[model samples]
Target chain A: AQSVAQPEDQVNVAEGNPLTVKCTYSVSGNPYLFWYVQYPNRGLQFLLKYITGDNLVKGSYGFEAEFNKSQTSFHLKKPSALVSDSALYFCAVENGNKLVFGAGTILRVKS
Target chain B: EAGVVQSPRYKIIEKKQPVAFWCNPISGHNTLYWYLQNLGQGPELLIRYENEEAVDDSQLPKDRFSAERLKGVDSTLKIQPAELGDSAVYLCASSFGSGAYNEQFFGPGTRLTVL
Candidate 1:
């Protein structure tokens, strides 16, 4: 069985400051991780994915995530937060062709 | 470059009523998925399709729910005699490939409210 955990329900950040959203996972084999964002009443938009490459991955909208093998964590990060970044973020792990998602984290960026 | 499209942005029906939702995946995308998302929760996969074949539907409630993807382009999900617990957002997503690492593109979901 595969599962994902996002401990925080909400994360608050200030505009122009760095932000981090924590995510952890449990899987039998190697994990394929991904991050997605969902705005109000909108569908989830893919941010980044970690398949089999560098630990640090860059994605759309100046977003990035670091994959920690030892810690079994994949945390989304942004260098400078923007009000537009306020949304719901989800971390997922792919088992076979199925993706299991975490509960999600609400990100609020204050301008 | 049209993304996945879904209809009936919002639907409200009394308990025991039937409802259906539709989805059209991105052009030439063979894999399609339907997910259910409750308030403040992550989306859970209800079913998955590869072309015209339903490759996965283990999580789907076959007792009251049914789905089909005829012609392998457009798909429909139906629930007969919906229950109050059925209220949630139904989302459709598609990926370019059937590979494990394929990134999925999502559709603006249909919000269903069962009264």
Candidate 2:
């Protein structure tokens, strides 16, 4: 079955340090990958998506994700982490008509 | 443009009680979706509607859960005889033009707690 996996349950980073949240996907066809962030008690917010573009996709809140076709991974990254960036990050891949999401990874940026 | 709108930011009810949540998708968005989000997990799609038609509802528990988008606009999801395991966040999202591939706008979900 088509699925996405977020290997990390939580990622800790010092403020101003680079942060990475790992994600891997398995699907039948070329995938449409996306990243979303959810704050406490809030709905998921769209970050970025990789459809058919350059491998590097930029998104909201100063976040970006690299889509590696050979590796079947779309990992979210930020050049410099911020305390405010701490939240639940989700990776998703579009199946036929729905999005299959990973378990999620908590990104905690400490000051 | 206004984002997708949902009512009842939070709801708590005893088991066996019936509860309903409402959603109003962004204007001109014909694709609507309802998802169930368990604690510490990503939201899972329960049902999806293409205008007034229910295209994909295989994941929805038809015995106790039902949803409708009557005029192809606002929608409602009803759960009868709620159970403790049913407690979670119900999220509503909508995308313009098509489904899955387009950008989907989400609303603040209704947090449900079954006691």
Candidate with the greatest lDDT versus the true structure: 1
TM (chain A) per model: 0.98, 0.98
Ten residues in a row with the worst lDDT in model 2 chain A? A36-45
Candidate 1 lDDT by residue in tens digits, B1-115: 9989999999999999999999999999999999999999999999999999999999999999999998999999999989999999999999988865799999999999999
Model 2 chain B: ten consecutive residues of lowest lDDT: B96-105
How well docked is model 1, in DockQ terms? 0.84
Pick the DockQ winner. 1
Worst 10 residues of 1 chain B by lDDT: B95-104
lDDT of each: 0.95, 0.93
> For each candidate, what TM-score against the reference?
0.99, 0.98
Chain B TM-score per candidate, please: 0.98, 0.98
Looking at candidate 1, what is the lDDT of residue B79?
99
True-contact fraction in model 1 equals: 0.80
**Candidate 2 residue-wise lDDT, A6-109, digit = tens:** 99999999999999999999998889999989898777889999998799999998999999989999999999999999999999999987998899999999
Off by over 4 Å in 2: none
**Could you give me the TM-score of model 1 versus the true structure?**
0.99
